[model samples]
Target: MKILDRYILTSFLKTFATVFVILFFIFILQGIWLFIAELAGKDLDAWLVVKFLLFYSPNIVPLVLPLSILLASIMTFGNFAENYEFAAMKSSGISLKRAMRSLTVFIFALSIVAFFFANNVIPRAHYKFINLRKNIVQRKPAMAIVQGQFNAIGNFNIKVDKKSGENGEKLEGVTIHKRLPGATNTTVIRSKTGLLRSSENDNLLQLELFDGYYYEEITTKKPAERKKVPFAKSSFSKQVMNIDLTMLNNNDMDKEQIAHTNTMLNLKELVYTIDSLESNYSKERQSITDNITNRINLTLSKPKIINPILDKKIVDTTEVANTLAERDSVPDKLLALFDTNEDKNRLLEIASNSLNSSKFVISSGQNQVREKIKSINSHWHSLYEKFVIGFACILMFFIGAPLGAIIRKGGLGLPIVFAILIFIIFHFINTFGKKLAQENGIPPFLGAWMSSFVLSPLAILLTYRATNDIGLINMDNVLLPLQKLAQKLFKAKSKEAK
Candidate 1:
């Protein structure tokens, strides 16, 4: 490579490394916080936590790369500009465009890497991250148990005085507060010594305690009428109970209850699901429309029939008087027209029931149609997550490069703060888009990409103006308007006081 190329490449790489380290540390800290909160009490190896973070690094790296590149480009250019090296290069017969060519090439290569990482590597890592956590949660019961706190393991909220052994296979003193779901009272069990073991056949964590007492507390709330008795305790030499975690979670049956969302699905799988859901929704809507039309046509085609039951005679005078709202209103001529009012009432009731049944069927069909449409909508909305996240790299580069050039600071202080602010805004907008898309059926692609799409041109315009020395709005300009407004308000306030 030429001296110029080497110099530019060196600057870009150095800035990239610096920005990456800072971002990666931030991601690592977040990972640690999440794992501690979620996986701390679980019986998993410390190495597994390390592995989880490391495996997830690629996922985070792609997200950070675009911004990092943008920042790196800006810093590299800003440093050259500040030191007058850009002028020196220009004096030495190197163009401004030429100086950036090396960096641009570097960025292009990086963008490709970012795309692959985000599209393929990151999605796979998400699955690994999810599955690793699932395995840890399912296989390791000891890690799930907290020392002092009440840990609801399976159906038991257990606390241990001391835990020993490498795998937490032994407990010194164990107190279990068990409450099966749908049960009225909680069962308290104390064991002098206990052992936790997993079932070989399934993911069931079992507790075998020795020399323990089982006490049940039943609350009777009729204090005025009933006497209160304390809990009854029963001592046992040894007790064994096995609880199946899998049995408790019927949602994880691997059935098609809900769509596995976008981040959870690969590209092919996501596309297939979208297509299938769309087709199903279309079919359901058509079926519902056809059913409603057929039902209406059937109703219209039905011949009117004269009912013998409605024309039945009323034999008892007392029954006739009770059935009629007013004897004078019914008129003496029509009073003996019906033989039996019960028959007429029964026929009217049958007609009402049939009408209600038809209405119910139509309503149910409409509900199903709405649900199917929602399923299709949800599938599309899910796809937006991947779409937005995948393009964040390109967007970050746009903003980062310009901001870095504008700030003219290479180190972590101002540049980092600005980068974080930009990221925060971007993330907030992205999240908002997701919420709107999910809830309101806002155009999925438009909603998800709104931030990046809107911001890109602004970034480009800023970068172009910065590079070409064309003036655009800056922080000083933004503050100027606010400052003027504040001054006017202050003057008005002072004049009024005077």
Candidate 2:
């Protein structure tokens, strides 16, 4: 039994390792393609690119590890069943559960390691990956400028029709648009030929143009008085410009700012964040409620009634009569309210004020509500994700192992298909649930574990079928009824035809 356990364990681990490497490499290549725009044609150093990929590699581990586990489990168990090893073990009075015990223990240990990786290692890797990418994005203007496109360096937009020479230092048909500070007009420089170089310290870009024209538009103080806006143009045989690189040089963001992001926090940090956010939300809600209540009370307490009888009448009775005397004038009945309308005006003013205050309160309340929901969802998702990823690995192993045994097919052909289909379903459910949680449509725990809940029952069913030596889909039971029904229908049709 010990020898048998060792053999199965060894084979399983070997398959796991092989699948993990293959999948990881595939995903790494995919990442490169995904970020090709950012990485390619940037003239980045080879080592910098390699380091960026290395930092980003850990981000894929959580996604790929579970997938590899699924595939490897399926292949290992399918191969064993295909070779009749499981039958031999059963003949020796070893039950399926006993045969799986060693592998199950090993899987449990792997889950623990996976959890630690997700908690400890992945966060730091994420931080480094994000900052490195940001730094790469902030590479010097010379490195970022591409030919035949408008490239922004500081406040200037530069375009080169063609770039040549060994280091791309020679430029042709160069155009630069420089916007002056606090001015609407842009300084445009067009050159038929140019030479480009960066300072030794890369603090500035030196562009020297030949046989070019410079144009600037000056805005007049009064556009209506001027027939045309003033403008200046100069044809220059030689021109030089230096673009400051100070903004691009400061590429590094505050480390603390990056570290505080949700992706860069581990389980412990996530828990702390959730607690802090919950506390803050509680206080904010309390404050909002109190403020709203006080505002409402003040609005309600304001004296809104005015005595109309004591107010002076603006129009006399004779004037009202004169207005009534004119046929085209408004009738005295309609104009009567104008003679004593102070109270109505006061009431209208009070109502308008109350409405405005109410609108402000409602708007503030809605904003606070949304902010609270977002904070809570973010923290909760981060917290459950730590455990969910780890548990998913174990659950996937159970599913794949039994499924493979029941199917009794080995190698990549069927196993890979089944693994991918199952994983797709899992990934889709997990994503949908997370979105629901983020939107506050469901509890965070349920949303986080929704995938596991859905797959667990299927895993149990597969395990049961494998243990009983039954087909995965019970094809005989399913197809027998359909076959009988078809035969009966065909017999009835033939009789009718006869």
User: Which portions of model 2 show Cα errors greater than 4 Å?
Assistant: 141-200, 205-243, 247-259, 289-361, 483-498
The clash count of every prediction, one per candidate, is: 14, 0
Report RMSD for candidate 2.
Answer: 9.1
Pairs with backbone N, CA or C atoms under 3 Å apart (clashes), candidate 2: none
| Model 1 lDDT per residue over 143-249, tens place | 67756667766777889888788777788788998887898778989989998886444566778899989899767777753355556779998999877776443
Q: What TM-score does structure 2 among the candidates reach?
A: 0.72
| TM-score for each of the candidates | 0.62, 0.72
TM-score of 1: 0.62
**Candidate 1 wrong stretches, greater than 4 Å:** 92-95, 142-241, 244-260, 287-391, 472-498
**What tens-digit string does per-residue lDDT give for candidate 2 at 1-498?**
599899989999999999999999999999999988778766777888888888899999978988999999999999989999998999999977888899999989888998898889888888988887766756756866689999888889999999999878999999999996787887899999999988547688889999999899877788673558678999999988888888777665323234467788988888888888889888887777778878777543533222224535555666555654664565556435555578667767887898899889879887988778876897788778888888989999889999888888889999999999999999999999988998899998998899999999998998888888876887788899999999999999999999
Error of 2 at 197 (Å): 7.4
Model 1 local distance difference test score: 0.69
**Backbone clash tally for model 2?**
0
State the displacement of the C-alpha of residue 370, model 1, in Å, after optimal TM-score superposition: 6.4
